[model samples]
Each structure stands twice: as structure tokens, then as C-alpha cells.
Target: MSSTKVIYALYNDDDVLMDAVKQTRKAHHHIEEVFTPFPVHGLDKAMGLAPTRLAICAFIYGCIGISVATWMMWNIMINDWPQDIGGKPSFSYLQNMPAFVPVMFEMTVFFAAHLMVITFYMRSRLWPFKKAENPDVRTTDDHFLMEVSVSGDEEAMIAFFKNTGAVEVKVIEKH
Candidate 1:
């Protein structure tokens, strides 16, 4: 199998990493990926990544959850077996909506949270028993790694990363 050569720039501080990312973009370098010990605020923006649409998916999931809960409660309390509890009759779902509010809210939150997590994992290509794709162990500890696809002048790319406050730079063949 043919392998692609890429540059990996390691930084010690998140701030420095952020600046390096900005400079790399300014110089028109295409960043492949970035690995960090923790989430870096605005890193995605620096890397020119588009905003995530997970919130929209969460809203849709929440709507589905509430709809399911409403249908289930209506079927159980109103359609299947009508009940007279606390001197209240289950004649109309609208009239009994206040009583079902708790269930609706719980279902909405549950579905939104759970489905959003699943969607995020699926979108990220994360799966059970997946092998780790991290390039360096230090990225999981206290370092940040920036991966850039090399196009021309490997030596100049190394010099550019070093000027951007990278602690170390290496070129490796990525499969």
C-alpha cells in the first residue's frame, strides 16, 4: 500500500498551538487533523472547520421523543384505557397535557442527550473496539499535535512549524 507523507508539529502550550494553527492557515497549509490532551476552545475555527450541526440533530431528536411520549401516553391513558384519577378524567389529551408534561420533558431530554451522543460517535467514525489512531502518546498527556499534509519543500515546512513555536516537528508516512 502507498503511504502519504505528513508533517506532525508538537506544541507544549495550547495557546501556542492555537497561534500556530492560525499561522498555518494564514500560510495556506491544509491541516489534516489536530490531537490535544483536552478540548481547545476556538481550535476548530482556527483550523477553518465549519460549525457542527449537532444542535440541529438534537432538536430533531427531541421533537421525535416528545411526539413518541405524547402518542404513547395518549394511547395508554386516553385511547386504550381511560382512567379517572385525582378527580380528573382522561377524556382529552389537551386537558390532560399538564399531567403528561413531566413525562414529555423527561423523554425529550433523554432522547436528545442519548441520540446526540450516538450521532456524534457515528459522525466521528467511532465504534466499539476501534483501534486508537493517535500519532503520539504525548498528545494524550500534556502536548498538542498538529498534522499537516506536506505538498512541497519539506525542510521549509519544518522551519515554518519551528517558527510557530512547535516544540518538535517530524515527517512521517501515514497510511
Candidate 2:
């Protein structure tokens, strides 16, 4: 496969960046990625990205946590050593489920939150001592960066980006 050339467009304002994204899509230019200092609402829909499935993963993790909590409580309270506390019966788990409700709920929340964080970290390839891959440091502050892959022509793409209100346009050839 041949190497690719990418155009980096820098925008100072989020509103201008949003409009540029819409215009680029309408012009049939493939937008590689967009970097922003903060989340831009409705930006994903404009870029035609698929909806995230992280919430579904969280729900699955929550179910696992509740199941573990129930099993542990049943074994500890009813099966291992039956003890009467607060005049509540310990013979049947169902009879004492009300008391365990707090524990169950806490565990569910804990697992969903912690595991989701870990999953995000892993999926993003984030780890201690990893170097950052941001092309422009200004994007982490107040600027936005839009990367577009150039196919046939370079000057026309640069002109197109300038017309889209890019503050700076740089052409990068990737190895």
C-alpha cells in the first residue's frame, strides 16, 4: 500500500469547527479525526460516528456484581453459620433479602463504575508512562484540530480547508 498525506486544519472556535465539519461532510471529504479542548455536543452525529456501547457494558457489569453479592450474602448469612440479628430470621435468604438490599445496590454501583473506568483505559490504550500522540498541543487548551486524509490533490484540499475557516493548515506526509 502507498503512503498517505494528511491535512491538519486548526480552528480557534468550537462553533466554527462545528460548521466546518458539517461543510466538509457535505463536500464528500473524509474526515479522519477531530480534536477539541472540550466535548462538542452533536459533533459525533455530524461526523456519522456510531453510537457508543459503553452503557450496555455497564449494565452487564452491574448484573454480575449483584449476582456475586447475593451469592456471598446467602452463603455467609444462611448457609455457613445461621445467626439471628435484630430478631430477623436467618434461615431463609428471601426473608433477609431486605437487609441485604443495601449491600447489593452498593456492589452493583461499585463494580459498574470501577470496571467501566478500567475498560475505558484499556480500550484507549492508556497506561502509565505512555507518551501522548497529540499533533498539536494547542488542541488541549483552546484550539481545535481537524485531520483529513488527502487523496488526489493537495492545493485544492488546503484551499478548501481555508475556506472552511481554518486558522492554520498544514500538510503532513505519513510514512
Candidate 3:
């Protein structure tokens, strides 16, 4: 694969970075990515990013959890070894559903949370022992980095970033 020239603009404050994002969008610049130490509220809207669909995945995972819990409980209590526990006969799953509410709720929450984390990690291409893809290490601590792809006019882009409160701006050849 070939490398491309990209400009990295480092900002000290998230407020300044947010403003710069707005100005960059206004000036019709295509921002490749932005890295921040913490989540910056409203930055997604400013960057025109689409809303995440992770909630849909969570809902599906929850449904799967509930179904599995119901099936497992039915097999254990009603089919495999039906027995009288706490003076209640394990005759019908529907009749004994109230007793299984806590289990069902816990399973639903457990599946949703665990599966969501796994899904997020997979989607973001994060894995154990993998090297960080961030261009600047400072962005993980106190700095914010904005990457803008440049086809021409590197000097103008650097000047634009400096004008927008960038602490440092440099053109990098991204592999």
C-alpha cells in the first residue's frame, strides 16, 4: 500500500479543539479523524458523524439472553427433571415465570453488557497485545489530535490549524 500526506493538529484544550472542528467543517475541510484523552460531548455532532447503531445490537443481545434463559429454565425445571421445590410444582413454565424473573433480568443485563463490550472492541479493531494506532502518544494523556488529509497546499493547512489554536501542526506521511 502507498502512504498519503496527512496533517496532524495538536490542541491542548478540548474547547479549542471543538471550535476548530466547527471552523474546519465550515471551511469544507475533510477531517480524517480526531483523538482525545476523554470523551468530548457534542463533538460528534460538530463532526457530522452518524448516530451509532450499537443500541440495536444491545437490544438483540438482550432478547437472545432472555430466550436462552427461558429455554434453559424450561428444560431444567419442566422437562429434564421436574420436581417440587418450595412447595411449587414445576408443571408449567408460564405459571412459574414469576419465580424466574430475577434470573431472566440478570441474564438479560449480563448478555447485553458483555456482548456490547465485545462488539465494540471488535468494531474498533482493538485486541490484546496490539499496538496503538494513535499518531501522537500525547493524545492519550492531555492532548487532543485532529488528523486532516491534504491533497495539496500543506502550508495553508498548517497556517489554518495554527490560526485555530493548534499548539503544534505537522504534515505526516501516513502508511
Clashes of each: 0, 0, 0
**Overall lDDT per candidate, in order of appearance:** 0.96, 0.94, 0.94
Candidate 1 local lDDT, 1-175, one digit each (tens): 8899999999999999999999999999999999999999999898989999998999999999999999999999999999999988788999999999999999999999999999999999999999999999999999999999998999999999999999999999888
Give the clashing pairs for model 2: none
As a whole number from 0 to 100, the lDDT of residue 22 in candidate 1 is 95
Q: What is the TM-score of each candidate against the true structure?
A: 0.98, 0.95, 0.97
Better of 1 and 3 by lDDT: 1
For 24-114, candidate 2 gives per-residue lDDT tens digits of 9998899999999999999999898999999999999999999989999999999999999999999999999999999999999998999
* Angstrom error at residue 162, model 3: 0.7
Clash pairs, candidate 1, are none
Off by over 4 Å in 3: none
Model 2, runs deviating above 4 Å: none
Candidate 3 lDDT tens digits, 12-122: 999999999999999888999999999999999999999999999999999999998989899999999999999886899988999999999999999999999999999
